[model samples]
Target: MKDYTIHRGVDYRVYESEPTTFYAKCTQYGAGCDWLIRVTKMSRKFCWEIRKYNGSHTCTRATISQDHSKLDSNTVAEAIKPLVEVDPSIRVKSVIAKVQAKFNYTISYRKAWLAKQKAVESIFSGDDLVPNIRVLHRVFWSYYPCIRAFRHCKPIVQVDGTHLYGKYKGCLLVAVSQDGNNNIVLIAFAIVEGETSEAWHFFLSNLRQHVVTRDGVGLISDRHDSIRAAIARSNGAWSPPRAFHMFCIRHIESNFLRKFKAPYLQKLIVNIGYSRTVREYETRYQRLRERVEANTNWLDRILREQYALAFDGGYRWGYMTTNLVECINSVLKGARNLPVTALVKATFYRLNELFTRKRAEAEARINAGHVFSELVTSKLHANQRAAGNIQVSCFD
Candidate 1:
């Protein structure tokens, strides 16, 4: 009836709107137009049936307004869905123009804006917003293939959070891993209100419950207090036999630089954390100590097992930093500028591209009669050549 009234350019006024009856009549009820309709629900059929119908509208419009009550926000929302899907950032003015073009009527700024909001929500499913948020429903996601690939890869996971840059607010948290061939696989993701402890707790809980299931997994990240607090509340899910938490050396270097304002000692700071043995660690520590004892107090606050490779029980896998997760952030840099739903879709397609290309390359190598990945095959051949130079001594 709303569509019919809008199309026919007729005015209507409802006298009775009830569950059992609907009565509408021409707005010029007494002048000359006798157009009216009364519909009632048949109790037996439970369906609407027209009980009375008068003659066609015999009156024309007295005045035309800039808006139509029949063309409300919900109606306009359905009309502009295609436009919203193509460009979520389309302006409110564009929405008004679209309504003018399609409906032949101009809508108010508030109505056009409301229509666009509805279109975006219907298309993208909306996002969990952050700034000045009162109620939050967090969404944490992990692709199935990526989660399934974790057991086949090395027991290491690097996690990080990057800030979104466009119309949407909040931080994008990602948990990434690598296969034997050093292919970066993004396993899990979430959007949260900055790097708060509660947010990290939500992300990590979903990651552990669904993706990071294997034992002795190495969890690498910066020493953010929120991350530490979240770990402390994990009930040993991220500790000891289950997993080991380690700090990134790059962040340590940045912290040291920030505190002491010394660039010359940054290399030494990295080398100390990169050291694979006690002697190497001591050598690097002494070198830093000799060069500058000036205001470098974070050195005294170091943890060997968390940052130093010499004491990390081989779980670091020779990785001294969260550079891998930073690389993932770089890959998603452009996506950060998109709306929340588009950003998530971008990640899905991005991971699909990576997986598709890598799978093809791996299959090609195997079909060419290689039993291992290119990295493993290269190491095996290098080992074979080195074995000819070895001389065994049998003195027993």
Candidate 2:
């Protein structure tokens, strides 16, 4: 009806309605024009019925305006911004339907698509300035409360990368750390073509120079060739005496399982990785070597200290896995399907929600006189109970 009004230089209004029927009459009825339309709903589907028409209007031309539609790209973008933000996969037809329903104006599918594009750009780029996105590489980076939060967070940082899905092909590289409450805190992110050594170097070089400025920070990640080469090419930026590097023990076990085809070695390898003392690690590792002599060289090739928490000299702080960073990947599962700019904006919105919710929860907990987070308090109690049962020996 809105589309007809805009195109035909006439207006319409609801005349009457029954349970299954709707009647709309043309606004030229005062001039004795009988142009009208009727629709009947049957079993939930609607069918149109042109009830009466005189073909030619008897009304004077002074009352009607033969103007184009008032709905433009900006109007459509503003109308659908909330809908698109909620679900990036929203269909173009849905946008058309929404605009027709809200503003009584039907837009073309092309207009809806263009509106979505404009809205996405408006979201990623602020109203004041457009986003500083590079066209050549299609790379973007974001640092939120991460910069301030990292100053107080532990020095242990985890790095990981996952592939993106959309019209453009790329990978999302992420840096994550844990706050005092053991919450996963995202530090930075980058989108690149793939996990090449050059890409890793670019990500790491920026991370070192801009993101993580603290010296002797610990870095944990999978032993991807690109990551290894990038760290090696860092010219001691990520090397010892400044920043220590370690491999995720879970990734190492995955490789061992894939190559050895021995499910039994899984628990044994995990035990060795989690061992707190060299004696225990040696015992478990020797058993593994004896059971799998043919594949012992594969295990020996990787630096034990990188995967074994017992050999890491407490640098890992009991976290031998990259699960924290993987959690961030899981949180961003939906955003990965969006375009590069939308993906970045989605992360920004998600991080904003996370920070706000956590800050409110922290304040509430503090008001309740809690000195530590619930997890930490519970751990303290459990350790205290265990300490009371220990038998201390004064004589050596």
Candidate 3:
């Protein structure tokens, strides 16, 4: 028999046998002990079993062992310490290499790079912490100082939405500026789930809040009915501060041409687009309007209304046309398929690259004692000279 304490100040007499089981008699501590213990073992060591001692002498049992062991929290913490200490950049590269190996036949390096970036992004993404669209928009806006510089200028805000594809497929509305130098600058960007009147209205409302502008700002955009509806909804507060709203001449011409479907009338409409004065525009407009009236009276009325509104003196921005929005759309081409944050980051990077190139070109021109516009004009003139006998007109 081996004596041992089984509970607080309660002593037990333990008995061991060949089967490696121990039996114990409980002794009283404070409460009377009416329990007996049986210890059992199978392979390595003896184990204790406790049971209520019914006078019938049948045993009830619970198992306990002294040699049981498990890895402690400290051991686990130490084992994982090295993995935590490993440089994340190195880990990322290793994971990237493995992914590239697995998909080597299907995807390109650029796509692989984007995938790796997405994976890194996912580690920080979770249900509780999604990326913020506003933060992305701010990152985009920060790249263009020209945008901030002209924030108060009564800018002609042009907006057009285009579909994008990615983790979150949606549409993007881009706000742009035609600065004093005739250069187009991106002002802001937003991504929405769809191109609904409500979405456009919401986007415009947000733009109204973030874009600080002086009174009398002008807005130019395509004649999408949803856009018109959005502008109408914004009549009181988000309305363009100015008394002018301009429609894209190209969009209007396209609309007019669609109804007529006449090659001669299309040529005539193009002439109106290239015309210098209102008198010239009126002459061309009258000619097309008559042909249009002869063909379809209803179509003629619509064309005249749209043409009059678009060509009205207040809407014209210097040249006979304005399509800087098309330039913006082109710049956003490659990035339209990215996630919202990626779209914003890519937009800022691309814009910065564009302006950096432009700045370099401008500095080169200055060093050579020639202005950028002059250099472009001189190049155009040289090209025109080489194409002798052809008349060239400088529209602006």
Candidate 4:
């Protein structure tokens, strides 16, 4: 019997029992030869056939051929030479072209070029991110930072939801954080069918599972009714462990605007956001109410009812804003119209690109020995220090 090697650029092992079956195996390209091949004779005139010890199918007899010669390792190697050099990239490009041709009539060349460019840019960005397993793991860690088991540290969680458009048209809930330097960091994300209380609950539950501590960590989100309901459901001695939840004031003001349309009241409500005390808020609210009454009593009622609901201290989370989620939503805008798999892949690619840019910026800053805060201050104030008599702290 004689043995032959099967090669298709990728490594593969092949064996045959007899010369005839070996010839058939070579002819079928290993497609029909599943069992080991055993060589019986390798004399001046080699003769061979194949048999399956495990009862696997044998190669077709008609596919076999014979050439009288001594079969050796060299002969088998020679037989496999041409098959090893097939270029996989050429085959891949051919397949891509064929697929593209099908849509050629519907899409213009310029549009096709743009699509290909977008796909490549999305995949090869500097973020050390890829569409496969690596990026998947990165995404998991980004939005779920609590996965890292720090011995004793407060978990910072920021939650917000955004709408996505596509075949499934839904909302994506994202949780993120801020580093000591105040840079936004992603934590975890969930794609839900809708922004209902049930959806928010499911997202929060899944998010909770990824974190180490829930007690001291703070969970921040917009003042959405669904979110409030989810938090309410989380109450009780038997409740899922609670994170000190806070609501973003921006969402509250937007809700107020939607309910109360009086222009003067709208201005007053904006002022309430800048108020330092409850007295200031009440004073502004009354003035706004009187102004609304002068125009229309019905508007006053609507504004008062909405203000009562929004200002309930239970819902406000300091001056926390929804900008982080909004940033992510903007990054996802283009890819939201894709299929689920495509959407996931595109998001990772885009995020990787973002982090890659961030890493580069950080490296550049380090290389220049430039403190980021100083740079920010210089850029904002053109390097002019505030008057000594009236020192200004930016945070204030």
**RMSD after CA superposition, every candidate:** 11.7, 13.7, 19.8, 16.3
Location of the lowest summed lDDT over 10 successive residues in candidate 1: 387-396
Candidate 3 lDDT over 343-368, as tens digits, reads: 66566666777778878997887877
**Candidate number of the best lDDT:** 1
- Least well predicted 10-residue stretch by lDDT in candidate 2: 59-68
In TM-score terms, candidate 2 sits at 0.67
Clash count, one per candidate? 0, 0, 5, 17
Kindly list the per-residue Cα lDDT of model 4 for residues 187-274, writing each as its tens digit.
5667777779888877776566655344545565776788878877755311324445554546656666676654445556656555
TM-score of 1: 0.61
Superposed Cα deviation of residue 77, candidate 2 (Å):
7.7
Q: What would the per-residue lDDT of candidate 2 be over residues 1-396, giving only the tens digit for each residue?
A: 554455455666687888777887766675766667677666644565555554654544464332224466787788788888776656778888987777656678888888877776677555645378447573647574778899989999999999987556889999999988888889999998999999999999988987888888889999899999999999999988888899888898898899888887888887888888999988988888888686667878888778887788677878899999999898787677677767876778778888899889979978676655666899999998777666343231
Model-by-model lDDT, in order? 0.85, 0.80, 0.54, 0.50
Question: Once model 4 is optimally superposed onto the true structure by TM-score, how far is the C-alpha of residue 217 displaced, in angstroms?
Answer: 4.2
Q: For model 3, give the RMSD to the true fold.
A: 19.8
TM-score preference between candidates 1 and 4, better one: 1
lDDT of 2 at 159: 96
Residue 225 of model 3, lDDT score: 82
Give the runs in model 2 whose Cα sits over 4 Å from its true position.
Answer: 1-79, 86-134, 138-140, 366-396
Error of 2 at 36 (Å): 7.7
Ranking by lDDT: 1, 2, 3, 4
Deviation from native of the Cα of residue 144 in model 4, angstroms:
6.2
